[model samples]
Target: MPKISNQNLFDALLDSWDRNNTILVNLLQAFSHGGLEIRAMEGGPSIAELFTHMHYCRLIFVLEDAPECARPINRQEWASEQDPSVLARLLNESAAAVREAVKSRVEAGQDMLVHYDHPILMLQHMIWHEGYHHGQIKLALKLAGRPFSDDEAGLITWDVWMNKT
Candidate 1:
């Protein structure tokens, strides 16, 4: 059996992680403040709430497994913030924390066994979870009469995750 080097794997993982984070940032920046209030269903979470929830999930994971790398935030406070800029700032901060936590763990050769047994699984969990919520947020935006063209949506969600061409 060939002994494979994991350096490439780690680098690719980090790239995938960063790509997923950019999806959120791009989606948020694509819309206006009023669009944050849009909801897909009458009682479903608004775009702001969905974003807040995604950040909250990341924050909680980091706080529990990598407190030193976590940037603490009041979930209620962030959810109440209607300003898109503020929300974007908060999202970036949390994303950085998660990135740091993952990077540090990889550098230190550590495993986040408290929950997901390993760093890669945890990272995949975050990426998958955020992707699900991003879909909902986009759906909400579409329901609110603001939406990306199919090409734009393809670019934002699909092409962005692909390797640089």
Candidate 2:
């Protein structure tokens, strides 16, 4: 495979994070009003809680690893029923904070030890965690009889990765 320059590699990583954030916000926005109350299973976290938890997880890492990026992210009580749009905004903000924290660490050649992992691992963790939650969100919608069409789901999750609108 052809090798990419360091800057290109970093940009790719940052773009991936941005796409992740976009997918997440789009998924949440796709929900109808009150769809946030949907849950994947009985007694499981609602869609709102899932979104909130994702943002909370990001904050935990940023607060510990990059306090400067933590200011814009307000701390919310876990699993609270805040508005979905509000959660989306917070998620975007937190994602930007994560991007900054990771970028600074990589550029300065500094090691960030969060949960015994480096910045790259931390970003991987966040992406994996959010993707898992995205599945849960979709499942919740389906369980509530409001599932997205195949095209919609594909666009939100897969096409976003390809940088397609």
- For residues 1-165, what per-residue lDDT tens digits would candidate 2 score against the true structure? 556776588788888888889899988768646777777888788778888888888888878886766655446636666587787778888898889888888778777755635677678888899888888777777877887888988877789897543
lDDT of 1 by residue, 58-150 (tens): 889998887778786685733755787877887888888888888898788997737767767778999989888887877777777887677
The lDDT of each candidate is 0.79, 0.79
Q: What lDDT is reached at residue 131 by model 1?
A: 84
Checking candidate 1 for backbone clashes, the offending pairs are: none
Please list the residue runs of candidate 1 whose C-alpha ends up more than 4 Å from where it truly belongs after superposition: 1-5, 163-165
Q: After superposition, how far is residue 19 of candidate 1 from its true place, in Å?
A: 0.8
Best by lDDT: 1
Question: What is candidate 1's TM-score against the reference?
Answer: 0.87
